[model samples]
Target: MMSQAAVRQPINVMIVEDDNVTRKYLAAAIQSEPALQLVASFDSVQPALAWLVSTPVDLLLTDLGLPDGSGVDVIRACVGRWPDCGILVITMSSDEDSVLACIEAGAAGYVLKDAGHLDIVRALMDLHSGGSPISPLIARKVLGRMRDAMPASSAPASNADARSLLTRREAAILNLIARGDSYGEVARTLSVSVGTVQTHVKNIYGKLSVHSRGEAVFEAQRRGLLRMATLKAREPG
Candidate 1:
């Protein structure tokens, strides 16, 4: 008897976009990928919320703007009912408040509508793999907000000791990541393999006691570990 090839399961994806053309485009793009399955799609908030009541999904891709109401409600619902499901926001909104609201409402990833279809797909994949995918521009804004939110009191002297835990290479990798470079892009910039970049990131996460990229960045910023100079925006490739 011949051994059988292992079959991989497709990720179940749900989409909620009020625009008909955009909805179809998103659905088609998702369907084009063999690793993703279009489980359900909604044009507004209510239907998406109603569908979530009985159905379970691996990922929820939603727009912030809806004809009836905000998509944040749907994100919150998924977080409440299906806590394990990863939520990704795809929207045209790049304002600080909108980005912060989605992040506060339990969204794992946020990408602008201007991102290529492949970029959106890659973001979903990253979310599936325990990564938080945030667009470069949105990332800068988030970091800026974090910097501004810092208390007037200086950080403890112990923060420097804690910062020293990261190796030079690890710090370099973290800097690149904070600038919104993907693992692959970081690898290319550092002339290393993607796996190597991921390993360093994993170590950075451990040292920072964070589970995701956003948390790592936030914690690093809080500890005064990041070089603000390196955080200047770079044009996303």
Candidate 2:
């Protein structure tokens, strides 16, 4: 096995941003980063999702809003097909709902498009390295939403407690989520792929009978599990 500190080769990255200027900027940013190799950049989720199935991509930086379909489809495809490939979001929508949807769909990092080239490059690097890179404002928004909805999710569980439903790994992942760590961050911390992290999270959600991260956190807290913060990465109803 490779050492933890060992550096891997340049990550083969794919971009799926829709804007022309943003796409050019993303391509340039990837080209400039020594650790990143641009494999392909597309304007929609359809072609990108199609490309991801057959390609061995190391990283994927996609936008949430595309002309054809939302970027969530792209994230789901990558997570389901190329579990090893790390995924990041670069979008104008920083709403808690949108962020949660991307997270539930299996994105590792969520960064806004307003970020500069260096910021984007850094976020991608962090994500590729197993870190959850989210914008500051977006992070705060998530926290606020969880806090606001805490009352409703505070109800107690029966003999089949929420905590007992999840495995040890799932519990650890929930703790990381409570601490505001992204899927990629949890994966890196556990030395697993982003997809694996999402799988564990999905199992956790299933066991707790929760849909969103915030609901999970609230449910865990109600059942006297790991109590810290809240989040939920699922599509809005």
Candidate 3:
């Protein structure tokens, strides 16, 4: 096994936002951190996807609404390509559907656009440190949803089986993929290759006995491996 010292490395981040102003601001924030390297910034999903195919990164900070497509697509591509990469959805949308959909697709963190730069920085650090972070408001919404989903008669079982079946990293990647992150985004966030991400995904699928993303997500939900609200609460801000 690799030593802890050997495993430690600087994080590479990518920002995908349609607004030039926002993109620049995010890039600047990422650059402010000594431990984080700003790899690239893009205005649309297509170029970001293309860049991801050729380059490697550690994290993806994206807006849900993009010029060409939804930020969710960017997440999907990243998770498909980079399974170890961390995915954080930074968007203006606070609608429950948008939040739930992103979580179901595999986002590790979700923050509203209103969140300050410090919050975003803290969130990125939290995610890098293996913590799932969500905005406070988002967390409340997620908690409410979880409460609503729970059966009144019985408490939900902790997904010890599923948790034991996969490493924390694998679970994180799977969760993001379930939320909507792309292979490329996953690769970048995890600082691994796309092929590596695919390998992990394949392993996850085999272990879960699921074929498609939908099936994997359903299984994850059934196994109690993913609690939509719990993940949100784990976020930094």
Which candidate leads in TM-score?
A: 1
Please provide TM-scores, in order, for all candidate models, with all chains considered together: 0.87, 0.64, 0.63
Tell me how far candidate 2 lies from the true structure as C-alpha RMSD in angstroms: 7.3
What is candidate 1's lDDT per residue for 1-237, written digit by digit as tens? 543424567899999999999899889888987889999999989999999999999999999989999999999999999999998999999988887788778887888888555467777887887667787778787788887888757666656786788999999988888777777778899999988888888999988887677778778887777877787747555
> Which segments of candidate 2 are over 4 A away from where they belong?
1-7, 115-118, 152-237
Off by over 4 Å in 1: 1-5, 115-118, 156-159, 233-237
Local distance difference test, each candidate: 0.84, 0.75, 0.74
lDDT of 2 at 61: 91
Q: Kindly list the per-residue Cα lDDT of model 3 for residues 1-237, writing each as its tens digit.
A: 899767777799999998888788888888888788898889998999999887877899989988898988888888888878888888888887887787667677777787554456767886765445565566555555665676754444555555788878788887776554556667798999867877787788888996444446556765667657544644554
TM-score of 1: 0.87
Worst 10 residues of 1 by lDDT: 1-10
Native-to-model Cα distance after best TM-score fit, residue 202 in candidate 1, in Å: 3.3
Q: Could you tell me how far off, in angstroms, the CA of residue 17 lies in candidate 2 after the best superposition?
A: 0.9
Error of 3 at 51 (Å): 1.3
Pick by TM-score: 2 or 3, better one? 2
